[model samples]
Target: MPAPAISFEFFPPQTLAASFRLWDTVQALAPLGPRFVSVTYGAGGTTRDLTREAVATLHKSSGLPVAAHLTCVDATREETLQIARDFAAAGVTDIVALRGDPPKGSSGFVPHPDGFASSVDLIAGLREAGDFNIRVGAYPDTHPEAADSGADVAYLKRKFDAGASEALTQFFFEAETFFRFRDACEKAGIDKPIIPGILPIENWKGAARFARNCGTRIPDWVTDAFEKAERDGREDLLATAICTELCSELIDGGVDALHFYTLNRPELTRDVCHALGVTPKADLKNVA
Candidate 1:
C-alpha cells in the first residue's frame, strides 16, 4: 500500500529550551513532506500570541502550509475573528477552530461572556472571516466532557455543517475504534474527511494518563506489552513497532490520511512514519 498523506500538530513553546525542541522537531519531520502542519493554542488561550508567532514562523521558514488553531476561550467574538483576519493577512489560510479548554485551576470549560459558545459557533465565525480551509476536532472515544461517542460524532457533523471542511480525530489505540466512529459519522450523513490522530507511545505512563484524561480507551494487551517492554529495556523498539502496526491497519481499513499529535517530540513519530513506508525523499516534491 502507498504511504498515507500525513500532518503533524505542534504546540507553541513557552520556554527558550522548548523553542529549540520545537525547531528540532520541525527539522526532523519537514522532509517527509506533510500535507500541512498545525500549531495549537495553549490552555485557556494563554499562548494565543505564541501560537500565532509560531505559525507565521513555520509558514515563512519551512515553506509549508501552517494551520493556526483558533479557540473560543477567554477572548470576545470580535477579538477571535480579528485573529482569523490577521492569519489571512499573513498568508496562513488553514484554520483549526475549537472551543478551548477553560483556564487552569478553574472548573470545566466556561465560555467567555461575549465569546462564541462552542466549536460549531467558532467554525461559523471563521467561515465568515475569510476563505479558510477549516478543520475541527473529533473524538472516536467518548470525550471527557461529552455524553458518549454518538454525541461526539453528532457534534462533529455539526461542525462540518457550520463550515468545517474536515475533522481530525483524537488519538485512539485500536483501528476498530476509529472504523466504528467513521461508520457512525457516515451514517449520520457527514461527508467531510475524518482523519485519524496517531500518537506514538513514547512514554507509556504519560500516554496512559493523557488517554485517561481524554477518555481514550486503553486495552489490557497494550498495557501489558508496554510493561514488559519497559522491564526488558526495549521500550523504544516496542513503541516503534506498535505505532507502525497501527498505521498499517488504518491504511488497510480505508484511511487515506493521518494527523500526528507530535507533542513537540518528533523522534518516535518520525521513525514510525519511516517504518510504515513513509520515508523521506531527496527530491523536494510532494507525494501522496
Candidate 2:
C-alpha cells in the first residue's frame, strides 16, 4: 500500500519548558512531511492566546501548514471571528472548529450568551467570516453527549452542511470502529473525507482515563496487555507495536490518510509512522 497522508496535532505550551518541548517535537516529526500540523486550544478556550501564538509561530518558522484550533467556549461571536480573521491575516487559513469542553469545574458545555451555540454554528460563522478550510470533529465511538451513534453521524452531517471541509474523528482503539462509523456516515448521505485520529499510547493510565472520559470503549485485552507490559517495563515497546499494528491495519484496509494526536510527544508517533513506511524527506527538516 502507498504511504498514507498524515497530519499531527499539538497543544499550545503554557510554560517556557513546554515551549521547548513543543519545538523539539516539531523538529523530530516535521521531517516526516505531515500535510499540516494543528495546535489545540485548552479546555474552555483557556489557551486561546497561546494557541494563536503557537499556530502563527509554527506557520512562520516551520514552513509547514498550520491549522489553529478555534472553539466556542468562553468567547463572544465577534471575538471568535476576529481570531479567524487574524489567522487569515497571518496567512494561516486552515481551522479545526469545535464546541469546546466546559471549564474545569463546570457541569457541561453552556454556551456564552453571545457566542455560537455549537460546533455547527461556529462552522457557519467561520464560513461567513473568512475563506478557510474548515475541519470539524467526529465521534467514532459515539460522542458522550450524543443520544446514539446515529445521532453522532447526523450531527456530523449538519457540521458539513454548515461548511466544514473535513472531519477528524476522536481516537479509537480498533480500526473496525472507524470503518463502522464511516459506513454509517455514508448511509447518512455524508460524503466528506473522514480521517481517523490515532493516539499512540504514551501513558496507559492517562490514555485509559481519557478514553473513558470521551466515551471510547477500551477492550479488556488492551488493559491486560498494558498491565503486563507495565509490569515487565516494556510499555514503550508495547505502545510502538500496538500503534504500528493499528496503522498497518488501517492502511491495508484502504485508509489513505491519518491524523495523529501527538500530545506534544513525538517518539512513539514518529516510530509508528516510520513503521508504516512514512520516512523523513531530506528537504523538509528545517522546522526549528
Candidate 3:
C-alpha cells in the first residue's frame, strides 16, 4: 500500500541571514511537494508581521499552500481574528491555531485577559470568523499541564469538537505512543485526521533541551542512536534512518499524513520524504 502524504513547518526568519537560510530550505524541499507548509508565530506574537510576510511569499512564489500559525498568547480575540481576516485577505485559507507559550522567561502560559483562553477557543473563533481549514496541536503523551494522557486526548477531542478540521501532534519519538494516542482519540469519538508531527533530531543538544521543557520524551534508544552518531559526525545520515524508520512505522500503523518541523533546514526532511517514496508535485496556481 502507499504511504501517507507529507506537510512541513517553518519559522519566519528574524534576520536577513536567517531569511536566506529559510528561503534556501524552502527551495530545496519545494520539489518534494508538501501538502501544505506552515510558518510559526513567535512567542508573544513577536514575529507576527514577519510570519505574515513569509507566509504570503510562500503562497505567492512557491506555488505551495501555506498555513499561517496563529496563537492567543499575547493578542486579544478581536486582534487575533483581525489577523485571521488579514490572512484571508492575503489569500491564505488554512491556519494552525495554537495556545502558544508565554513570552520568553515567563513561568507558564498566561492567556491574554481578552484573548481566547485555549486552543479550542481559538479553533472555535476561527471557525466562526471565516471558512478556514483549521489545525490544532495535540499532545500524544500529555501536555505538560495535562493531568494524564487521557486528559490530553480528551482535550484534543474538544478542539476537534470545536470544528477543527485536522490536528498536528507534538513531535514524539515512540511510534507506539502515537498509535495509542490515535486509539484513544478513536475511543473518544474523534474521526478527524491526526497528522503525526516529525522533527528530525539534527541538533541533539538543542532538541534535548526543548524536548525536556515541552514534556516530550527522549527515549534511551533515541539518545543512544544520536550519541553513537555524534562520535562520527554523521547526524544527517542517522537522522535520515531514524526519521525514515519512525515514519515507516507510522505508515505501517495506518497513518495517512505527516507534518515535519523543518527548523528552516530541508535536506533532512527532503531525504526523509524521498525515503518514504513521496515526491514533490509541480507548481500550481495561487489561491488568489
Candidate 4:
C-alpha cells in the first residue's frame, strides 16, 4: 500500500524572533504538502488574539490550508462563538476545538460555568457556529483527568457524535497503543477519521518530560538510542532516524495520514516526509 498523506501542528510565536522561526518552519515543511497545518491556541486562552493573527497570516501567506485551534477553558460561550465567527469570516474553515489547559501555576482545569465544560461541548459549539471542518483531541492511553481508558474513548466518541470531522490523538510512542485506540474507536462506532499525532524525538529529555506529563509512554529503546547519542552530538541525525522508523512502522501497520507535532521545528519533519516519499504539490514550487 502507498504511504498516507500528512498534516502538521505548530504553535503561535510569542515574540518577533519566534515568529521568524515559525515562518521558517512553515517554509521548510510546506514542500511536504500537508493536508492542513494547525496553529495552537495558548492555554487558558491567553493568546487568543495572537493565535488568530497567526492563523490568518498562514492562510494569507502560505497558500496552504490552516486550522486554528480554539479552546473553551476560560472563555464564555458567547466569546468562543464570536471567535469562531471571526475565523470563518477570515477564510478559515477548519477548527481544532479543544478543552484547554488551566492557567499556568493553577492546580487543575476549572471550567467556565457558563461555557464549555469539555472538548465535546466546544465541538458542538463550533458546529453550531458554522459549517466548519471541526477536529478534536484524542488520547490513546486515556486522558490524564479521565476516569479510565473506556471513559476517555467514550468522550472522544461524544465529540464525534457532536459533529467533529476528525480526531487527532495526543502523541504516543508505541504503535500498538494507537492500534488499540483505533480498535476501541471502531468498536464504539466512531467512523470519523482518527489521525495519529506523531512527535519526532528532537529533544529526548524535554520530550520524555512532556510525555510523562501528558501520560504518553517513553519506551526504553527510544531513550537508549538518545542516550548513546549523548556523547556524539548526533542528536539531530538520530532524531531523523527514530522518527522515520516510527512513521514507517506506522504506515506498515495501516495508518494512512499523520499529524506531526512540529514543535516549531521543521528539519525533522522535512526529513521524515522525504523518507516517506511525500512530495509537495507542483504549484507550490516556492514553498522551500
Candidate 5:
C-alpha cells in the first residue's frame, strides 16, 4: 500500500516549560512532513489567544501550514468572527471549527448570548468570514451528548452541509470502530474525507480517562494488555507496537490519511509514523 498522508495535533502551551515541550515536539515531528499541523484550544476556549499566537508563529517559522481551532463557547459572534479574520490576516486559512466543551464545573455547553450556538453555526460564520478550509470533529462512537450513533452521524452531515470540508474522528481503541463509523458516514451521504485520529498511548490511565470523557469505547482486552505491560515495565514498547499496528490496519483498510493527536509529546507518534514508512525527508531541513 502507498504510505498514508499524515498530520499532527498539538495544544497551545500553558507555561514556559510547556512551551519548550511544544517546540521540541515540533522539531521531532516536523521532519516527518505532515500535510498540516493543528493547534487546539483549551476547554471553554480559554487558550484562544495562545492558540492564535502558536498558529501564526508556526505558520511563519516552521514552513508548515497551521490550522487554528476556533470554538464557539464563551465569545460573542462578533468577537469570534474577528478572531477568524485575524487568523486569515496572519496567513492562516485552515480552521477546525468546534462547539467546545463547557468550562470546568459547568453542567454542559452554554453558548454566550451573542455567540453561535453550535458547531454548524460556527462553521457557517467561519465560511462567511473568510476562504477557509474548515474541518470539524466526528464521533465514531456515539457522542456523549447524542441520542445514538445515528444521531452523531446525522449531525456530522449537518456540519458538512454547513460548510466544513473535512471531518476528523475522535480517537478510538479499535480499527473496527473507525471502519464501522466510516461505513455509516458513507451511508448517511457524507462524502468528505474523514481522517482517523490516532492517540499513541503514552499513559494508559490518562488515555482511559480521556476515552471515557470523549465517549470513545475502550476494549477490555486493551485495558488488560496495558495493565500487563505496565506491570512488566514495557509500557513504551507495547504502546509503539499497538499504535504502529493500528496505523497499518487503517492503511490496509483503505484509509489514505491519518491524524495524530500528539498531546504535545512526540516520541511515540514519531516512532509510529516511522514504522508506517513515513521516513524523514530532506525537505524538512528548511524548517529546521
Candidate 6:
C-alpha cells in the first residue's frame, strides 16, 4: 500500500525547558514531511497566548503548515474570532475548533456568557469570521458527555454542517472501533474526511487515565501486555511494536491518512512512522 498522508498534534510549552523540548520535537518530526502539524490549547484555554505564539513561531521558522487550536472555554466570541483573524494575518489559516474542557476544578463545561456555546457554534463563527480550513473533533467511541455512539455521529454531522473541513478522531485502541464509527458516519450522511488519531503509548499509566477520562475503552489484553512489558523493562520496545502493528492494520484496512498525537515527544511517533515507510526527505529544513 502507498504510504499514508500523515499529520501530528503538539501542545504549546509553558516553560523555557518545555519550549526547548517542543522545538526538539519539531526538529525531529518535521523531517518526516507531515502534511500539517497542529498545536493544542491547554484546558479551559489556559495556554491561549502560548498556543498562538508557538503556532506563529513554527509557521515562520519551520516552513511547515501549522494549525492552531481554538476553543470556546474562557473567552468571549469576539475574543476568539480575533485570535482567528490574527492567525490569518500571520498567514496561518488552518484551525482545530473545539469546545474545550472545563477548568481544572470545574464540574463540566460552562460556556462563557458571551462565548460560542459549542464546537459547532465555534465552527460557525470561524466560518463567518475568516477563510479557514477548519478541523473538528470526532469520537470513535462514545464521547464522555454524549448520550451514545450514535449521538457522537449526529453531533459530528452538525459540526460539518457548521463548516468544518475535516474531523480528527479521539485516539482509540482498535481499528475495528474506527471502522464501526466510519460506517456509522456514512450511514448518518456525513461525507467529510475523518482521520484516525493515533497515540503511541508513551506512558501506560497516563495513557490509561486519559483513555478513561475520554471514555475510550482499553482492552484487557493491552493492560496485561503493558504490565508484562514493564516487568521485563521492555516498555519502549513494546510500545514501538504495538504502535507499528496498529498502523499497519489501519493501512491494510484502507485508511489513507493518520494523525498522531505526539504529546510533544517524537521518538516513538517517528519510529512508528518509519516503520510504516514514512521516511525523512533529503531536503529537510532546519528548524533552528
**How many backbone collisions does model 4 have?**
0
- For model 3, residues 1-288, the per-residue Cα lDDT tens digits are 585788999999999999999999999988777789999999888899999999999899988899999999888999999999999999998999999888998888888889999999999999999999999999986788999999998898899899998999999998998999999999999999999999987798898898987899889988898998999999888889989999999999988899999999888888888889887665566435
- CA lDDT of each candidate? 0.92, 0.95, 0.90, 0.89, 0.94, 0.95
Q: List candidate 3 segments past 4 Å from native.
A: 282-288
For candidate 4, lDDT tens digit of each residue in 92-131? 9899998888888999989898888888888887888789
Model 3, C-alpha of 147: deviation from truth (Å):
0.5
Candidate with more favorable, higher lDDT: 3 or 6: 6
What TM-score would each prediction reach against the true structure?
0.97, 0.98, 0.95, 0.96, 0.98, 0.98
Mind giving the per-residue lDDT tens digits that candidate 5 earns over 1-288?
688899999999989999999999999999899999999999988899999999998999888989999999999999999999999999999999999999989999998999999999999988887799999999998899999999999999999999999998899988999999999999999899999999999899999999999999989999999999999999999999999999999999999999999999999999999889998878745766
Score candidate 5 by lDDT. 0.94
Output candidate 4 Cα RMSD.
2.0
- Which parts of model 2 have CA positions greater than 4 angstroms off? 284-288
Alpha-carbon lDDT of model 4: 0.89
- Residue 146 of model 4 has an lDDT of 82
lDDT of 2 at 26: 99
Residues 75-113, candidate 6, lDDT per residue (tens digit)?
Answer: 999999999999999999999999999999999999999
lDDT of 6: 0.95
Residue pairs with backbone overlap in model 3: 32-280, 33-280
Candidate 4 ranges beyond 4 A from true positions: 284-288
RMSD of 1: 2.3
Please provide, for model 2 over 177-286, each residue's C-alpha lDDT reduced to its tens digit, 9 standing for 90 to 100.
98899999999999999999999999999999999999998999899999999999999999999998888888888799999999999999999999888999977355
